[model samples]
Target: MPKLQGFEFWKTTLQEARYVVAPMVDQSELAWRLLCRRHGAQLCYTPMFHAQVFVRDANYRRENLYAEVCPEDRPLITQFCANDPEVFVQAGLLAQDHCDAIDLNLGCPQMIAKRGHYGVFLQDEWELLEKMVKLAHEKLSVPVTCKIRVFQDVERTVRFAQMLEKAGCQLLTVHGRTKDQKGAFTGMADWEHIKAVRKAVSIPVFANGNIHHLTDVEQCIQETGVHGVMSAEGNLHNPALFEGSSPPVWEMAEEYLEVVQQHPPCTLSFVRAHLFKLWHHTLQIHQDLREELAKVKSLEGLSEVSRQLRLRCQEEIAKEKEGAEERPRGDLPFPHWMCQPYVRPPPKVLVPNGQSQGSEETKTESHKRALEDSDGTPDSLSKNKQKKKARNPHKTFCLELKPKYMKCEQCGNPKGSKCVFDLCRACCKKKAYKEVADCPSHGLRFKTKADRQRVEEERAGAIGDQEPPDGSQGLPETHNTEQEVH
Candidate 1:
C-alpha cells in the first residue's frame, strides 16, 4: 500500500473522534453538523460541493458553501466533487481555511454523477483520481481524504482503498455497498469487504452504512477494525445515536430547530427533511399528522409541528408512567427508515391512440413558436385539427410488460449492462451533464429561501429576455425537444 502524508495527523484525529457524521448532500449542513456534534460525533463533514461551480461561480460558493463553523466545530471536513485536477485544487484552496481536511466524493451512485464524469463513475479512471488527490495533498494546507463505495470484487476494492492511500489520501471512508446496490437493494453493507480493505491500508478507515443504531457502531468497529463509523440516514433519524438509543423525535427536532435558529437560517426543505426523519416512527402511526408535516414550508411551521410532537411525546411518556399501554411500532418490513425505497412518480401514460394524434415532434415545434410569438397566443386552428384527428381513445393507450429488474432505465442500457443509478445508454453519449439540474426546480437542491427565489427570478428573467434570432420568427430549429432521460 502506498503511504500518504499526514497519516499521523489523521491517526490522532481518528483516535479522538471514533463516531463521525457522513457528508450527506443536503442533510449534513451546519445545523445537522451542530446537532451531531452535541450528540458525540467527534468529526463532521459538510455537504459535497461541485468543484467546477465552486471555482467558477462566486454566487454559487456564497449560496452553497455555508459551513459557518466555530472553534468547537473543529475536525470538520469539506467534501468536493470534481472531474478535473486543476478545478479540485482551486476548490480545495478556497475551502482549506475553514475545514480540517478536504474530502473527495467518490461514492455518489446517482445517474447525474455518472453523466458528469465524477463521483463513482470516475472509479475506472485510476490515474485521474490519483492525480487529483496528489494535487490536493501537495497544494492544500489541510489533509486530503476520500469516501468511496466498494466494487463487486473484494480484491479490486482492497486495491482501490490502497491506491487512494498511495495517492495521498490520509483518511479513507469506505461505504460497503457497491455502486449498483442502491435504493431497494441497498441491503446490508459487506463488513467482510470493509475488514479486508482496513487490513490492507495503513491509513485510518471509516466504515459507513448499516449503522442503524448506536450499538451498530460498536459492532461495526469490532468486526471491521475501522478507525471510525459514519452514519447518514441513521443519524438523521437519531442524531443522538453516537450517545445511545434516541430520546423522542420531538426532543431532537426541537434541539436542531433551536441550534439552526441561532445560526444563519437554513432552507425550509432541509429543516422539514430532518424533522421528518426524526419523527419517522411517530409519523408512521399518525397518518393525518404526517400529511400536515409534509406540507410544512417554513421554520415557523416546523416549530409548530415540533411543539405538537414534543407535547405528544411528553403525554405518551406520562401515560406509560401511569400504566397506559405503549403504542405499537410501525409494521413496515424495513427495520430502519432509510431502508425504504425512494418514492418515484408513476410513469407517464401514453396517448390513447397507438400513435400520437399529432407528431410529438410537430407539437414541440408548435410549443416553441407559441413561446416566441409576441402575443404568446395558442393557435386555435391547430388545436381544432388535433382534436379532429383523435380516433378511438380505447385503442390509443398502449401498455408493455415492464421488467421486474432493469439495469438502466434512463438511456435503456441492455439487460446485460446491470449498472444501477438509473443510467441508460443514451446518457453515455453526452460529454457532460449537471447532476442536480434534473431535479424539480423547487426541491431541496436549493439550500435556502433566498437561493430558490433568486433562481426563480433568474429563470423568469431569462425567459422574458429571450429574443428571436435575426430574420427568424421562432426559436432556433436545433432547440432540443427530447426530455432528459433521468
Candidate 2:
C-alpha cells in the first residue's frame, strides 16, 4: 500500500533538496535541525521516541519529544517505535497532526533496544515489524516511514526493505552499519548495501552515515547513486552542506553563524557546541587552529577568534589560488590531521535499546568541557619542527606542548594547552589506552583519554535518565519522577 500522502511527502522533501541530516538523538535536536533547515536541510527527523511514553506522559510530550518544533520547522518527522500496534497508532494519530510525518525506529542497535525489543532488534522478527508498519499506515493519514540498517548479510536486508515497502512505509532511510559492527572501527557505511535496499523497494531511499561535507555527499551519490543522501555528523559539521546543489565552505559557515547570532539569549554552551563540531568535523588539518577555536566561551570571543581564523582561511585559499594561477595545482597542501592516523573509541557492541540518547544539558556540558581548557602540544613549536615543515614533502610533525598543560600524557590538563593523552600523569598511570579517540565526524583527537571516558559515562547516565516507555520500564532511580514535563 502506498502512503496516502506519499507523493506530497517525498515530492516536497527533496524537490530542491540535496540532503537530509540523519536523526541522531543528541546531535539532531530541534535547535541543530533548525540550523540545518535554514541552510539546506530539506527534510529531517526528530530524535527517535518510544510510542508508549509519548502517550502515557504529557511531560515527555512537552519537553523531550516536541521541545523546539515551530511552524518554520516544517517538513519534519517525529520517529516512534512500539511493540503493540494499537499503542503506536494512537500516538501516531496525535504525532501526525503536529509533525509533517511519523517514522518507525526499526534500526537502533543498542542493548537496551534488544532487551526493550526495539531498534535493530526488530530486524530479527519480520512478522512483528510488518504488522507495526501496517498498523501505523492504517492508523495515520500523514506519510509513514521507517529507518533501517543493512544487516550483515545483504539479502536479509533486501528482504527486510521489501517487507517495509509491503507494509506501506512510503519512504525509507538506510544507515549502512549493521547491528553487528555497532559503529566500531569506523564501520565503513556500505553504500552498495543501501543501493540494494533502494533496488528492493520503489519508494524514495536516502543514504546515511559518516558524511562530513558537500564533497562527501557528492561522493556518496556517485558511489550509492541513491535518490538522496543524509548525514548526522556531516551536517553537524557544516549546517549549510546541503542545498539544491553543493554549497561553498565559507558560505555554509557564515549562514550558521548568522543563525546562532539571531538568538542572543542562547547560552554560550550551545553556540560553542555547534562551532566546535563545524570546525573539527567539516574542515580538515590545522589542529592548532581547531584546538584554539575550540576554547572560545562567549559571543564576543567567537567573533574575535573568527576574525583571526577567517584571515588564515583566506590566506590559505589565496595561496591555493596563486598556485593554480602559476601552475596546474588546485588547492593548498592538505593539512596534517586528515592524512594522519587518528584515535578510536570502545565499540558500541550492544546498545541498550531503552537507553536515552542525551539532553540539551548534556550537550551543553560536553561542549563546555571540551573548550574550557588548554590541552596537549607545546605552547610554541620547536625550531626543528618548523624547519621540517619547510623541508619535508610529507612529514608527521607534533605540535609543541606547554609545560603547564603538558604536565603528563594520561589525564589532560584542562588549564594547559589542550593537554592531551590524559597527560595529567595521574591518568597516564591509570591509562586504559595510550591515546584518546577523536570526534568521529571531525577527526579532532582529544587532549586526553579522560575526555573520551567522560563522553561515554555521561551518555550512559543520560540513557539512565531516559523517560521510560510505559511497560518497557527503564532506570527508575534516574527518572525525575518528581520533575514531570507538563
Candidate 3:
C-alpha cells in the first residue's frame, strides 16, 4: 500500500491525534506510553534516539523498540536526532515499519545536543535539514515528520516551517520557543510564532510548550490553530493531563507500575524517574520518603515506597477530616497527595554589583553573589570546597597562590614531574623514539634494537628446546637420521 502524506497521514494514520506526549529523553518509554494512552493521550513519541547509535547498535534497537511491542501503544512516532542526511534516512528506514511516522528531532537544546551538532543547533543549516527530511520522505515506508524549535522572529519561523513543508515533511510539531529558551531561561512559549507557522505550512501542525493542564492544551490549540498540542513536563507530572483530571499521586504511580509489570523489562531508571515526577509534591512534604525513593534500586522497592507514601497521605486526610490538623497550602493548587504540574521558577539575572536585580535568584546564584562579595577569601568557597580545603590547606583555586610548574630541561613547556629524561611530553616522546627506549611516566614505549634481537633469540631458543612429538627428550627422528647419514 502507498504511504499517506500531509493531512491525509495525520488523519488516516494518526487518527488526527489532538493530545500528544512529547518526545522526552529517558522519560517516554513503551510502558509510560501505554499508561498515558490509557489516560487519554491520543498520540505518543518515543524518546529521542541518537541516529548513529540507533543504526549501529542492535542492543539499542531491541531495548527501545523491538523487545516489546504493545498493540495498545498505537499511532506512535519514533524520533531520531541526526545531522547527516543519509544517516537520518537510514535510521528512519530502520524504524519506519514499527511506527506510523519517523520524526526528525530538531527541537532538542541541551548541551549534549549542542556538542553533537544535531537538534536545534542545525536549524540555521536549512539546506542540511531539507536534505534529511527529503531523503527520509523518499526512502521510508512511513511518513517523515519534524519537531522543531521556533526561531526568535515569527517570520523566520514561518519561513522555516514552509521550507520543511516543501521538502516533504508530512507533519510538523513546532515547539513555540527559540533554541536559546531552555532550562532556567524557559519562559512562556510564544503562541504567535506557532500560529504563524501553522498558517504558513500546508502540513498538519502540532504546537508544544506552555501546556500545563487540559485547559492549556485547549487554549494552545485554539490560540495557535494547530491540529494538536504536545506536553512533556506536564505529562510527566500528570499523565492524565489530556483527560482533564488530576488524579492522586499513588493512583498514577500504581497504574504505571502495573503497566511496567505487563510490559516486562522496562528500564528501572525510567520507572524510578516517572515515580519521582508523580510523587513530586508529596515527596516535598515527606522528605524522608523522597530520600527512600532516590536510594531504592529494585522495582518492588519502588512500589513499597509508593505504598508507604500512600499511607502517609491517607493519615493526613484523616487528620483533615477530624479538624485535628490543618496543613498549609503554600503554592500548590491541590493537596500534596494529588498529582499536579511543577512550575519552573523564572531565570535570575546576576547584576555587576554582587546583588541579584532581576527575578528571584536560585540558591547557586546566591552562593555566587556571596563569593563575589568575599573578595577571594577562603571562607567564600562553597561548603564542599571548604571541606576539601580543610583536608588539605595547601590546595587552592586562587591562581596567584598556586605553585609554579617546573619547566622541561629540553623545552620551555611544563614537564612531567617524574620524567626520567626531565622533558615535556613532546620532547620526551621524540627522545624516547630516537633512543628506542621506554618512558613509563610519559607513557611512551619504544622497542630498542637490542630488545628486539633478544626477543628473537628467545624465540629461536624455545623452538630448538622443543622435543619430538613422540615424547623423546631429543631431536626429531628425521634430524637424527640425517645426522647418522652424514
Candidate 4:
C-alpha cells in the first residue's frame, strides 16, 4: 500500500508511541501529561480544545496551550474539537508549531459536543470531515490525525477509516464505541470492529476502550492489530499504567503531587481531578476523607489532605493484615467501583499468518505467580505481615487513634458525614443540600477543641437566619463513563 498522507513523519512516531495517553476534557493537563510520560507513556494528547475558543480567545490559548513544552514532551498531539473546515485549519496552523501533529477530535460523545455540533455529531457529514482533515494536511507544516468513534454498521465504520486515510489523515485513532454509547450506555468497546477498521486502513491505527491496566495496552495491540493503544481513565487512576507494576495508590499519588508541584500554576480544578482519580477506589469507601480532599484550594492544602490519606491507607492495610479477610492484592481496578467490572478474557497472541498463538495467564495472575515464586511468599504480603507483627506499641496506638481524632464531638460521625456514615435528619431535609451530606460543623467537629469552636463560629456567621449553605461547589465530579470518546 502507498503511504497515507504525512506517513513519513507519523511512521517514525508510531515506532515509539505504542502506548499513548488519550486526550481528556478537564483532566489531561500538562501536569498530568508530564506525570504519565515519566511512567512510560510515549505519546500524550492535550485535552480536547474547542478550535473556536483556541482561535478567538487569547486567554484560553494562553492558559490551555500554556504548558512549558520540554524536549521530553516530544511527539505531542494537540487535539481540537471543530466542525468548520476553514476555522479548523486556522486552529491547526496555529498549533502545528508547538506539536508534532494536530488531531481532530471526532469521537467525543458528551452532550456539549452535540450542542456544539462537533465531535461524533460530525460523523455523518463525511464530506465535511474529509475536507477538514484535507485542509489541515494542505495548510499545516506538521501531520494531521483524527480520533473517531465507530459506527453501528461495520461496513460503514471501515469505509469511514478508508475515507480519512484517502483524505490525508496520517494517523487514526478509532474508539470502539459509537456516538450514542455514552454515560450509562457505554458498554464494552468492540475490539472486533476495531480489528476490521485496522484491516481497511493503511494509516497507523490506535485503539481506545477497555484499557484499564498496563497489560491491557499489550492486549489491545495483540487483539485489534492496531499500531498502538490509548488510555484515559486507566492512566488517570494509575499514571503508572505503562510501567507494568501495580504500585500502591498513595505512592502514585505522591509521585503525581511531586510532578504537579514542580509544574507550578496548575489550575485548582485540574489538580483536584488527578487527586480524586488516584485515590478514587480507596477513598470512595471513606466518604469523610473524600469530602475533605474535595474542599482543598491550594497545593499546601492538597498536600496535607494527601498526607492524611496516605496514613489512613496505611492503617487500612494494617487492619486488613491483622483481621481482614484475604482479598485481591491492590484495591480493585478503578472500573470495579462502577457496576460489575468487566473481567477481560485473556487475549490470544497471533502469529504472522494470523493464526492464534495461545492464551496466556493475565498480567495480574502472572504478577501473583512472580510474587509467590519469590521465597515462596509474595513480598508485599510478607512485608505487611512482618510489619503487623513487629510494629512498636506507640506507633500502633497513634495509628489506631487517628480515626478517632477525625470523628465529630456531638454527632460522633466523621467530617464527611452528619450521622454514622449517613447524614443527620435535619441537615438532610434542608433544601440547600445537594445529595452530598454536610459535615455539620455546628456544635461538633474534628481535630482540636479550638477547631470545633472555630467551625461553630463560621457556621453561625454564615447561617444567621437563612438555611446553612453547602460549601462552595468544588470541582465537579468527573464522569469518565465512556471508553473511546470524552
Arranged by TM-score with the best first, the candidates are 3, 1, 4, 2
Candidate number with the higher lDDT (1 or 3): 3
Clashing pairs in 3: none
Please give the clash total of every predicted structure, in order: 4, 46, 0, 0
For model 1, residues 147-209, the per-residue Cα lDDT tens digits are 999999999999998888898898899999999866544566899889999999988889998
TM-score versus the correct structure, for each prediction: 0.67, 0.57, 0.79, 0.67
TM-score of 3: 0.79
After superposing candidate 1, which stretches have Cα over 4 Å from the reference? 1-6, 11-15, 316-325, 330-486
Cα lDDT of model 1 overall?
Answer: 0.75
Over 1-486, each residue of candidate 3 has an lDDT whose tens digit, in order, gives 898999998999899899999999999999899999999999999999999999999999888887756778899999999999989888887887788899999999999999999899999999989988888889989999999999878888889999999999999999988887876567788899999998887889999998899999988888889999999999999999999999888999999999999889988999999999999888888999887897799999999999999999999999999987689878889998888999976546544554567443333122123542223457677767766687887777676766899998777999999988989999999998988888889887686556888999999989877856766676554676656898
Best by TM-score: 3
- Ten residues in sequence with the least summed lDDT for candidate 1: 360-369
| Number of the candidate with higher TM-score, 1 or 2 | 1
lDDT of 2 by residue, 238-285 (tens): 566674334434454555566656633344665566656655422445
Worst 10 residues of 4 by lDDT: 361-370
Query: TM-score for model 1?
Result: 0.67
